[model samples]
Target: MELKKVIILGTTQFSVMMCSILESEGYSVYAYSTYKEYLNSNFFMGCPVFLTEDLVELMGGVENFMILNTIGYSKLNTIRERTFADLKMREYDIMTFISQKANIYTDKIGQGCIVMPGCFIGNNIVLGESNVIYTNTVLTHDISIGAYNFIGANVVIGGNVTMDTNNFVGMNSVIKNRVSVGSYSIIGCGSNVIASIKSYSVYTGNPAVHKKNILDINSVNI
Candidate 1:
């Protein structure tokens, strides 16, 4: 049997929780703390801890080490891109982490998919590559999410929901049962989606309405 070595960046409580999950899955974990206080915590006793600022210096010839970003923020796309770029330049393999407690009943979870703690996934959920599901995000039965989708924290997705590629679902957003969200669409934070959203649209507010076209804009923060 082969053993996987994973390195988690960011030394928050979330990082420790993820490390525990990975360790239970038979992966050797190294926790990187951005703050010195986190390094001294009892939660990281069994795992090797390092300073985030000194990653480049400490990563000497360590190939095939999976780096998981445990930072919780809305603007994660830019952060992920930057981190991946840096790791790639150094020839390190990047990896994603999904909690063992997550109720995943999917046929396949794509590469680079990160499922955070307290996430509840239902049966027959098909998720594409590079999708991130933050903490407490709930996807009911028969949900389908496309590639490069960012599902924010505490979002609730009802059963039979289909979301296309490159969609951004904001925090606390709720998608009603059987709703279909189109490609490149953006759901604003705290919005409630009750109907099918069109492609490249920006939907927001309670009972989500199509406010504008997100594709017209140059940049999305996430």
Candidate 2:
């Protein structure tokens, strides 16, 4: 019998990492993009590299492959969202990947999500589309996360927390229980968020404070 083909949408470290995960799950993996930086390579982590335009033909049509995006938190999740939307518009079979090494306790994860190894998704958590939860992250029970959110490694989101769309929670940050984080916000690394963060804002520090709105900030470290 032939194996199922999966075409990852980037050639970054995230894509490389996902290759191992996908292969372990008995899927044949490949990587491709229009970006020159990613296209510079002939193969990515043992998966053949191809141009985005040649994907359907190379794989013998869209029906022969499944798509997974690994754009990795660029432009506050908008770039990843755009990539996912493009594949969907092209009628590709985009898939959500939950690593076998992770512990999932919910069935509420939306399509196109990537839940990486060592992550713990607790019970009754609602995860919307295209969110990427990185390694070793802990999302406690009853949390609500909207679409296109990027959750970094080792981050811990407490129970009943609500995270809006296009938000980036940096590595090792801890969002307190019942805190509501608004859309398009950035919670910087190592933050201990105890309060609600407003939309389009940047918050950092131990007890996270409003640094500035995302629109006003020219650059973000995370």
Candidate 3:
């Protein structure tokens, strides 16, 4: 049996991680980058870098390869979300990557999601499209996560929690059971979320509280 061909979209360090993982999964991995420097270099992480303009022709067609966006939590994940949307609009098949080391108990994952190694996804979880679940995160039973969310490493989301779209849950954070995290909210690293969060709010501290609305800020450093 022939291995599947995949084109990962990014030149970031995250792209290199995906390249290694995809190759381990029996994919003939290639990279696509908007960076002209990558084009001159010709390779990224041992995979050939294909230019954006020549991608379709080089791949023979969009049907010949799958696309996985390697954009991480930068810009509160607006860039990653937009890139996923653009790929969908262009009719490319987006890949959902669950690392072989991940322990998944549900089959309800959506398109373009990347579940990193050492993650544990429990029963009755619904993970939406283009979300990034970083290493060692635990999603307990009966949780619902929306599209474009960034769940950082070693975070523990308790059972029956509801997390909305485009939210950033920082590393080592603990979202208590049955808590509801609103859309566009930022749960700061190592915080303990004991209560329901409001939409667009920035939360931190032992028992997370609303710091400020995300829209009011000029930029978010998370």
Candidate 4:
């Protein structure tokens, strides 16, 4: 098997947790942090540590490095988006990570998928490319998730739920069993989805209802 070199952004506990997983998978890791004092600690001693401000210069000639953002909350997406653009401009392939401690039971997950710590993925789950599963999210049995889906922290997906492409599930949302969320749908935070959600709809509240159609935003019919 070919091994890949990885550059981890952020030096938080989450970053350290993911580094341990990546190391066990045989990837060479270099840790970067915005704080210089944090880099000198015993926690980061064994790994090569670089300042986040120095990423562009330090990344020179490092074509095979994959950037894994370990910052918690909404910051993960922000860093990922920025790094993705930077890496693309430099013609580098971007990579993502799933923690070893996570209970992932998916048959297949596409490239660029990020599964964070404490995630529990049940049997026969299928996730498409570039899907982000944040920390403590649980996917019950037989879930089918499509491309570019963003599943936020503490979300719970019940059995046999099918979410189509480009769906955004908010934090602490609960999707009931056998529910089908259509393409480009957005579920609001702390909502409960009990039925099938239509394409391009914005659903929220307990037993989530459509506040408005997302197609109304752009005037492009779904």
What is the TM-score ranking, best to worst?
A: 3, 2, 1, 4
Q: Give all candidate RMSDs, comma-separated.
A: 5.5, 2.2, 2.2, 6.6
lDDT values of the candidates? Answer: 0.74, 0.85, 0.85, 0.73
Indicate whether candidate 1 or candidate 4 has the larger lDDT: 1
**Tens-digit per-residue lDDT, 168-208, candidate 1:** 78999999999899877789999999999998788999988
Better of 2 and 3 by TM-score: 3
TM-score of 4: 0.66
Name the regions of candidate 1 deviating beyond 4 angstroms: 1-3, 8-63, 69-93, 215-217
Clashing pairs in 1: none
Estimate, for each residue in 1-222, the C-alpha lDDT of model 4 and write its tens digit: 767668776667767776777787677786554445445552464666777555557777556566765543332133444544455565545576777768988758876678877899999999876678988999988999876677889999999988887667889999999889888777899999999999878889998999987644234222
In angstroms, the error of model 4 at 71 is 12
Instruction: State each candidate's clash count.
Output: 0, 0, 0, 0
TM-scores of the candidates are: 0.68, 0.90, 0.91, 0.66
Model 3, 94-123: lDDT tens per residue?
889999999999999999999998999999
Lowest-scoring 10 consecutive residues by lDDT in candidate 3? 30-39
lDDT of the structure predicted as candidate 2 = 0.85
- Report the error of model 1 at residue 107, Å: 3.7
- Tens-digit lDDT track of model 2 for 123-168: 9999999999999999989999999999999999999999889899
Model 2: how far residue 37 lies from native, Å: 9.4
